[model samples]
Each structure stands twice: as structure tokens, then as C-alpha cells.
Target: AQSVTQLDSQVPVFEEAPVELRCNYSSSVSVYLFWYVQYPNQGLQLLLKYLSGSTLVKSINGFEAEFNKSQTSFHLRKPSVHISDTAEYFCAVRGSGGSNYKLTFGKGTLLTVNP
Candidate 1:
């Protein structure tokens, strides 16, 4: 079994400021990690993921996350944020291999970009 935990429920940052949304997970087995973003009035979108290979993954919109095995963390970061970047961010994890559709998601962290 796996579980995810987002350290902050809300993150308020001025436009263009650097920000980081912390996420952590726990599991007895290897897992695939992901980050999902939800804009207002829209469904969640796949922001970035860490399936294998490099421990770092980046989104097209300048968001990036690094999978740290020792720390069991996959924290999202942006050097500079925009107004459009404001949204709810969710961290998720799924057990590797098999037909397991069981994915664990965090409560989510709402990013509010202020002017």
C-alpha cells in the first residue's frame, strides 16, 4: 500500500516569485510518482511524472519535480510563477507493475499567485 502527503494545504506567492510545493509518500514497495494540476472549473491535468530513468521530471509550463528515494519525496518547484499557474496541485503514487489501478493521492495544495 502507498500513501501521499502534501505538506502545505495552501501556498500563496507573488507573481514571478519562486515557489515550492512539498510532497511526501510512504510505501513498502517501489512506486511511480506523479503530479497533477487542476485549474478552476477544469479537470485535472498531468503536470509531470517520475516513472523511471532520471529522478527529475519537468512540465512544459516550467514546473519541475524531483523524485527522491531516500527522502520519499517528490516536491514540485518553479523558479518563477505566473497568474495562470494558480491552481490546485495533487501528488499521487501508484504501485509499480501489474494491473493494479490503485493510486494514492494527497489532499492537494492550492497555489494562489498574488499580484
Candidate 2:
């Protein structure tokens, strides 16, 4: 499967802060970019996707990411964040080699929002 890897470590700070999570990926054929956020016990939400159109995309919760073709990676970043943003973030890609639509996620990023 097309693989995506996020390099963001542990992001920790006070409530209502700004944060950025970096992500990278490798693919031989065409691919789609995706960002998902995982809450405490929830699965994940479709933050955004870069299919075959724009290079810059944003989510409903103020999170955004850019697709870099040269670097072969997609990075997520936000200027201001909230306690609700505390969760695990993942970067994924769908390989165009075949009909497989499985996503290869990164190790995961932990965003800790403290009061």
C-alpha cells in the first residue's frame, strides 16, 4: 500500500495554543492525501483530503495541510489550537497501483492540551 509517515512527536502545551504536525509519505504511482484526527475513545474523522485537485486543503476544525509533490509528503499545521484538538493525528495515502484503497498511516502524533 502507499505509505505515509508523520514525523510529529509529542506536542504539549497549555490550552488554546497553536500547533503543527508534520507528515511524509512515499508512493510510486498516483496517490491521495488524507488527514484524520482520533479523539480519546473515538475512531477518527476525515479532516481533509488532497485527491486530484488542489494542493492546499483545510478541515472544518481549523486544521490545514499542504501537498508537496517535490518532497513527496503532506504536512498538517495550525496557527491556533484548542483543548479539543488534543488527540492523535494520522496521515494516510491511497495507492493508485491497483484497485486497492487501503490507507497507510503514520506512526501517529499525540497532541496534548493542558490547562
Candidate 3:
């Protein structure tokens, strides 16, 4: 079975500061990792993903994550964050082989960018 863990329930940072949201995954076989963000009344949106190819993946919004097979981790980071980046972020994992269409997600981390 595959699972995702987000240890931080909430992360607070001042505007224009750097932030990192930790994510860890566990699986017996190869897996696909994803990070989703949810705004205050909006549905979850895909932030970034690690499917194949490069071990390092990035998002357009200054966020990046590295797929570490040895450590089984996919931590998300951003050098500079804005108030608009304030939202809940979720880490998910799914098996790569099957078409199960099931993704195990973490509890989510709330990022609050203060002024």
C-alpha cells in the first residue's frame, strides 16, 4: 500500500520569505507523487507532480520538489512567498502500475503568508 504524510499542520511565514512544506511517502512499488493546493473556497488544484524522467520537478510559482527514491520523500519549497500563496497544500501518492485511479493524500498543511 502507498501512503503520504505531511507532518506540518500549518506553516507561517512573512511575506516575501522562503518556505518549505515537507512531504513523505511510502510504497512497496514505484509510485507517482503529487502536490495539490486548495484555496479558501476552491477545489484542489495540481501544484506539481513527479511521474517519470527527472528526479527534480518544479512549478511555475517558484516552487520545486525533488523526488528522493532513497529517502522516499518529495518535499516542496519556495524561495519567496506572497500573501496570495496562502493556502492548504496536500501531498498525494498513487501506484504507477495500475489504473486504480486512487490517490492516498496527506492531512494537508496550511501555509499562511503574513504581512
Structure candidate 3, residue pairs in collision: none
Model 3, span 8-79: residue lDDT tens: 999999999999999999988899999999999999999999999999899998899999999999999999
Q: Candidate 1 — which residues are off by over 4 angstroms? A: none
**lDDT tens string, model 2, 22-106?**
8989888888888888888998888999987789998887888999999997888888888878899888888865787777888
Q: How far is candidate 2 from the true structure (C-alpha RMSD, Å)?
A: 1.5
lDDT tens digits, residues 15-113, model 1?
999999999999988899999999999999999999999999999989999999999999999999999999999999999988766988999999999
In order, what lDDT does every prediction score? 0.96, 0.84, 0.94
Estimate candidate 2's alpha-carbon lDDT, on a 0 to 1 scale.
0.84
lDDT of 2 at 90: 83
| Runs of candidate 2 exceeding 4 Å displacement | none
* Candidate that scores best on lDDT: 1
Ten contiguous residues minimizing lDDT sum, candidate 2: 1-10
Ranking by TM-score: 1, 3, 2
